[model samples]
Target: MTDGPQGEATESPTRWKFSPVQLDESEILRRGLDAFAELGYAATTMRELARRLGVSHNFITVRYGSKLSFWRAVVDYALAGAERERNQLLAEHRDDVERLRGVVIQLYRMSANAAEMNRLIADESTRDSSRLDYLHQRFIKPFWDSIEPALNGLMAAGHIPRVPTHILYFAIIGPALALAQNPIADRLDPVATPTAAQDRNSTADALSGLVLHGLLPPSGSETST
Candidate 1:
């Protein structure tokens, strides 16, 4: 059976109902991400993906119909995983700031390790706004929305300076991308680059500091309601 996008079925229900075949979407995505990391999106082929999956080249065609389709499906799968992790993180934190920091750090750590798949998604995203939109809607946007209230609470408590939640999100993410892109991450000096754990703690401190002490021009200290 071929893997479709996250919401798409591995095989039609009719096919599964008649035949007792099983499919592994995560496994397929793992191999696809591996291939994309090593070969890049344009260079990676269905045959290579099949090779990684220990299946025949025809299997990929049979399952996904085309390379483009398979790649798109992989993107969905990756985003789905990110969304799952996000939900779990949010649940664990339960609308807490520290928990939100953990959530962002965990995602960054995952992306850092997912070199191939992350590369493919990044490249595709540059050319395809929809692909980026899919990622944002599934992972980034919800995460920001979920934490907005907490940020506002911090502001009211005088724990942080009042700022747009989106700005805070942008600040948090800037360092995350840095961690993912850091070359030291791939080497023995992984610690030289910020890991998820590192980002979690540092971001919390940075955000807290920013909240308590407004980082604005001396004249622009006025907080917007």
Candidate 2:
């Protein structure tokens, strides 16, 4: 609808009027994350994102300034909880193994919940872009490095295998990370269907046991290397 006579927006002559607007901010960010992850940065547009969220075409651009900025916001919202938990584990667990295990479990839990973030990470990791740099510096590197001390200590004691931490990182996370592929997960285990809570708890418990078994020394094989 066009404005009044001179193509100017009509305004209230007397009292001001304002109404409430209902918006789901979390849903907006989740949709934004999925869009960017599914469609690469070059292809994702603010107008399209707005349409997906049922907002005004220019709303995202006006509010977020640019697409890159919006992408950063989405990444932050998705990874913030995991980052916070990583810091908490570091602060609370003083012992080497304790800290390592705590961080591993938290990472696994967060990773399971953050499949879109993982997909985005996988996409960005293929190229040398600023988004990749931001992800590595802001979230990914710190997480992988947090367990180095424990790894070293265990390695020195002939506990875990002497694999480099990077390889070890992929080794420990790869299996759990496979949960991101819901198709394979559903098809492979069709006989046992569990509630979301039951699935999450069972996944964590099973992965933790599998990882620790590969890392920790045998019951009687704990000797300093």
Candidate 3:
């Protein structure tokens, strides 16, 4: 009787809730872009993507309608993000040299971050395909359209030596893509530590320096002091 009067029962907290977690479309698209970049268009399947993303296959199919459409969306998303970042970088830097350095650095970082995208594009370049056409029209052309003018302006102002835009374009992008694609980048640089391979800012700075030095006007003094 004394124990009954002194004791009170405690209630347990509920273990389950009914709220459903919402899936972020942008995040899903980003993951899809990475997958397609790694696997390419022919190899990447909606079911596989869904498995990787931990969602139903129907979810992707319903949202994107088809694998090709989804792939287009992924490409568009990645390119659009790059364009936005480039625009912001241009707005922030006033000097042509500084602006060009910023652009090179940004492209270097992008190539490093999206190495798979570079690989995928490289693969696409060897053959003719609708996807390649789509990429050229939608992404590549627009990118060049925006960047070529700035590069031309630099040349016009005599900040950089005059050269064919296409040649200059390759000079700027080729090294960055090669570094991203090749495993020999660390070996090529005497001071490239293990950390440098993974360090985006370090890679960007080094690449920008090299590109800027190459683009600069030739000094009249041919002999080194």
Task: Write the residue-wise lDDT of candidate 1 on 1-225 in tens digits.
Answer: 666887565867656543432347787777787787567766787667766777766666677777767767877776666666676777777545566456655655665555455565556545656656765766667767766666777568555566666677656555444434435553646546444445544544554444334432244355555
User: In candidate 3, what are the lDDT values of residues 1-225, reduced to their tens digit?
Assistant: 122444864433221111121457678788887788677777888788978777766666666788888888888777767777788988898776667777777877787677767666666766699999987897567667766767777677666667776778778767776655545665676475653356766666787678778786455523211
lDDT of each: 0.61, 0.74, 0.70
RMSD of 1: 9.2
Q: Rank the candidates by TM-score, best first.
A: 2, 3, 1
How does model 2 fare in lDDT?
Answer: 0.74
Give the worst 10-residue stretch by lDDT in candidate 3: 12-21
TM-score of each: 0.56, 0.78, 0.69
For every candidate in turn, the CA RMSD to the true structure comes to: 9.2, 5.0, 10.0
Model 2 lDDT per residue over 109-174, tens place: 766677788678777877999999999888878877888888888787667778766788777767
Candidate 2's TM-score: 0.78
| lDDT for model 1 | 0.61
- Order of models, best lDDT first: 2, 3, 1
Candidate 3: give its CA RMSD in angstroms: 10.0
